[model samples]
Target: MDIIPQIRAAMHTLLSTTTEAIAAAQQYVKRPDRAKFTPSTLVQTLVYGWLAQPTATVEQLAQMACRIGVDVSPQAIDQRFTLATADLLRQLVLASIQPVIAANPVALPILQRFASVRVHDSTSIGLPDALTSTWRGCGNATTGGGSTLKCGVQLDVLTGTITALVPTITGWN
Candidate 1:
């Protein structure tokens, strides 16, 4: 069928299943009375490489969702980013995908065989000034007032699917 329909169906299937990580992450989400991006849906977003994009903004993410027939606004998705609830979901998505990656199914590999999931890979997800102060002026050359921006990770340990994603961090000391 058309790409939108196909993507929509895939999104459905991705979020439809349940697992321990999903449950825990969901509880993590609701506990803070956060904005709406169910843990399952967040897991799907992270799993599908949506959040993995170095320069993917909420607007871009929402557009990606719309490509799959999801009509939510970028503003809404951007708001969800603050919850920090998605971090756990990111880990869960990585863990869940580890098996598919390891199998190297030659069909739909979630991660390439033996790829380095952790590295200095990121771009501007959104504009500099509009983001939170912490998100602005990154690395050692950053503006003094804000905290550093974060880059994300996706690792496949003896993989089938993604097994872990460390978080959008400022790298090591």
Candidate 2:
């Protein structure tokens, strides 16, 4: 089935609203010294690139931005992907979830038997020794002796949306 039209429609509906909410939140203050791209533009570009190609590289993202009339270097684009960027993207994802579910309801016959279906998974990433104090490691048992960051995500299978995402130090649990 053709999905491009649907994707475009969803983007049209959500992008501006999400961008406005993000701007109002003031999550990322624009620094006068380095204000090449607005949060909205960066968010839109990243979303588009991800949707178009999940494994797109920083260079590809930079090219995509250029195609859309924004001249930016791959390094600049990469630098923009900080913890703050992740938080902002997560917020945007959470915000668009309801609308996404509403637009694309689950129709699989096998899934109809359940009132709700959810899935959960976690991933751990090893961090540098410097981050040990900030994000405690899992000790000698897991990551040898370095800090580790673990993140868990709960997905609503029926709606094909993420219900929650929790990030914590590996030593927490």
Candidate 3:
């Protein structure tokens, strides 16, 4: 199987979901009355936009929206950032994460010697004191309260595929 078609199929699977299903699942849009940007479009815009440029600005994302056949302003896109949007994006990311198994694996003698080569790593990120209630962290001397989150990923080097993603919130003692 060609990798291009496989990738296209994966993308289509991710973006082909109905807006009604996403709205009901994520509760993103309550009333779709005369709404120009649907939940699907929003997710599509962000997914493709960020995939094209991970550090894309709101204006660039708006351009991506235009490419996807929606005309939304940068400010309009910026205003859409809320708790609901955050939750929706988070859920979409978690749902879209699947192991990528290529038909042709990497051609490396050392890597091929093993049946499978897996790697794992994790990182902890500090959060603002205001979010301590939600994501408690080990106390800090400066603010006396802090929050942190640990994120980890497992990957198969030979297949160049991500196997798992884990996110854990730290709690204060």
Candidate 4:
């Protein structure tokens, strides 16, 4: 099966076609009503930028945005690292992977001994000080105050399914 076309079509639908869906997914109370940084543009910039360079800087991401037809400064990109943007990105990720389903099953005596094999992992992401109100972090003399978001996930390997995507926990303070 040629999956290249399928990948292209999926990307097109996610990044450019479904305008209303993107807007609805990114809805936040304080989100400014402006065209400068649409949800799709932000999603494209981060997704492709990180894929191109895993450890990309804000300037690099801004350049990626430019390549995708949006002109903005690195500071503008930096300012976009907010709670709302995080939520939007999370929602997009869930939406993107929700359709995936493993077709073939692996044959293994040890694996078949159990009903399902589950894996769990968690990580914490530091955020700007402005987000302290939403995601409080450890306070120290050097940084005064900060914020972070703790994300955790659980996947069942037997059927290739994600059982949990918990992002409610805040930083350990």
In order, candidate lDDTs are: 0.49, 0.74, 0.75, 0.72
lDDT (C-alpha) at residue 162 in model 1: 43
Local accuracy of candidate 4 as per-residue lDDT tens digits, 1-173: 87778778777776755533856755642455666777778888998999999989999999999999999999999998876777676666656553442334456678988898888998766677666766566654434556655678777777777777777535433
Candidate 4: residue 127 Cα off by (Å) = 11
**Every model's TM-score:** 0.41, 0.57, 0.63, 0.61
In candidate 3, how many Å is residue 42 off?
0.8
Better of 1 and 3 by lDDT: 3
RMSD of each: 9.0, 5.6, 5.6, 5.4
Candidate scoring better on lDDT of 1 and 2: 2
Candidate 4: deviation at residue 146, Å? 13
Clashes within 3 Å, all models in order: 16, 0, 0, 0
**Global lDDT of model 1:** 0.49
Comparing 3 with 4 on lDDT, the higher-scoring candidate is: 3
Q: List, residue by residue over 21-43, the lDDT tens digit for candidate 3.
A: 65577677767796679888888
